[model samples]
Target: MSTDRFKDLPIHSYQSIRGDIQTGDLLLCSGSYPVSKIIKKVSKSRFSHVSLIFQWVDRLMILESVESYGVRIVPLSHYFSDYRNSGKPYKGNLYLARHSAVKDLVPNKLNAMLRRGADLTGQPYDIEEIVKILASVVIDDLTSIRNDKYICSEFVQECYKKAGLSFQDDGRGFIYPEHISKDPSVKPLYELIP
Candidate 1:
């Protein structure tokens, strides 16, 4: 069997991207799809500070959450940015079966911790747990991501979205609610590695 032949096939389907599924094909899912015109407008606007921050936070959170689930977090920056700049939705979504077979280079410890926390908690795990876990790393990454603005912002935005908060950074730190130690309503992040 030649690998070339498989490259020509339509390897993805839409239904798989829209619901719970398990299969051998691994893929990445991003923020609320079918991005509304409002979201699109806000995402590209110059002064939509709230939306911009939210999107960045949501993206980073998704990246970490998914990575924790053991999936290889391919920044896929080139792919995503190319698609966004081209005004097209990303089409590589799929459902992967986390059997004891396939493997990738990304670590799975964070994913396991997330799963354990969820198990101890419940379907809608306490947002505080997620925030506490994420905030612990946010500052660390902020200090190291000086060369990658997109990624730094993405991380911050995802955490904000998952934690249901808003923020404004002064380059050195952030400004938001003082007593935000409480959790916010968020969906359970799924696992990707077996």
Candidate 2:
């Protein structure tokens, strides 16, 4: 499909579809912060961040590797209400995405994926990797993504890899949200309002 299909998506109300979000779903964000703008400009991607959505028993939570906090879990509802302790909705467009391979994950693989994500919790965000990504290569090699620290895409990419779904980017380098968005096996599920 053309990239056009990924643009002009219809926004969906968060309240109406919160119940429909499944574990392994993705939250793709186009943030407006200064750093977010830098990422988008450098990567040439509309989305600057990506977070994995997991259903932990009775609640939905987001697993993301963010600057300052590293990899952490947050209540999914925080985005629609107060995000970043800023008392505002997220500062950019939010899109829900899913990998076609998620449904095929057997119990063992699913558990393994969750476990891997959990293990990475509290790790630091890869600030060095960000510098490396933006400094040397204009077309970033994303080479250091597999290190202990992670970027949001690295965490999500690593988790999905555990679930038996491997994105198209070779394991050689880090995966970016733009790369994931362009993958054939991933599809947009919704355009979340805030």
Candidate 3:
């Protein structure tokens, strides 16, 4: 694919960016995949994946549940580098957003959410849940599946719920990344362009 496909899009450098991204910021991505395409089409949104950010020691890390890796912590630099090395800008494009209501949360509450995510590291990705989510989209059902496994968005929703931030219900465990992006309480922070 050609970088020209994304030439007109705004680009921002991670190194040149100002200000600290506090813990609990949402990292949204327009992933390139058949599944991602379906998600974008069904949700009528550009985002396909969502991750939670947390400051781990001196570095910022993303907590996300992916089909291949399940729940894992990836350094922000590594995440950005993946896009830079890929050459295709749109494949790597990512947006950072924060829960508009999280500003009211005390430091303790924010830390609690981060801790909850950290504690879940290594859990297997819920492949079955992904199927259920896709099926729900096709059937126009918004019901969330009850399961011990987690998808990226479901994990994020659970973290917020643990921290006492309630997003509009989209079934018990069926929240999509688009759901998080569309929530009135989320505000875009920055875009990482190639």
Candidate 4:
């Protein structure tokens, strides 16, 4: 893996990378909050929610492009903090997935379901954690958005809403928006995320 272009890509902590190590394993890196937040922003915009999901699907296509290589990529559940605390570089059985797989996979009918699984079930999901969850999710829709460039963000939002526990916003600095507020509509800052 030439990591030259991705040198800037955040290196997950040693613990985060270690637990998922497997020789020849493909690594899936992603975030939960940023994804949903972006979706929300797109939803609030004039563009249809479908257009937002389409954009996200396009991004997923870029992130998950490695699957095209025929390598099975997997998601990691540990936090980058765990990896960082471990104080070691990932070695032994981990590989980064192709960029396309990261961004494009979500658009496929088969993979879209997998992405939904990640968003909904990625408990304790953070940036690296979400990636790992997504990696583990099985792709069932490969052609849903093949011809179309837009996906309905409504579906994606529903997935995030279902996450219930486990999922957290992975935006640069933003935590859960609803969590910070007291309003019922506002998410609580901290909840029992399984």
The model with the greatest lDDT is 2
The deviation in Å at residue 17 for candidate 3 is 2.0
lDDT of each: 0.27, 0.82, 0.74, 0.26
Tens digit per residue, CA lDDT, model 1, 52-102: 110122232122222122222233232334434564544432112221221
lDDT of 3: 0.74
Worst 10 residues of 3 by lDDT: 1-10
lDDT, model 4, position 156: 30
On a 0 to 100 scale, what is the lDDT of residue 114 in model 3?
82
**How do the candidates rank by lDDT, highest first?**
2, 3, 1, 4
- lDDT by residue (tens digit), candidate 4, 59-172: 211112111121111223222223223643322222232212222223344344445534433232133322332332343221122111112222233333333312232232
What TM-score does each of the candidates earn?
0.21, 0.91, 0.83, 0.19
TM-score of 1: 0.21
Q: lDDT tens string, model 2, 77-180? A: 88888898888888888899888888777889888888899999999999987887787456544466457889888888888888777666535475678778
User: Candidate 2: which stretches are off by over 4 Å?
Assistant: 1-3, 138-142, 170-172
Choose the strongest candidate by TM-score.
Answer: 2
Better of 1 and 3 by TM-score: 3
List pairs with backbone clashes in candidate 2: 142-174
1-194 in candidate 3: lDDT tens per residue? 12122234445776665245778888888877777787777666677888988877788888888878888888777665563346334464687778877778888888888888888889889888777666776677556656667888888987898789856546544677877877877877677753
Query: How does model 1 fare in lDDT?
Result: 0.27
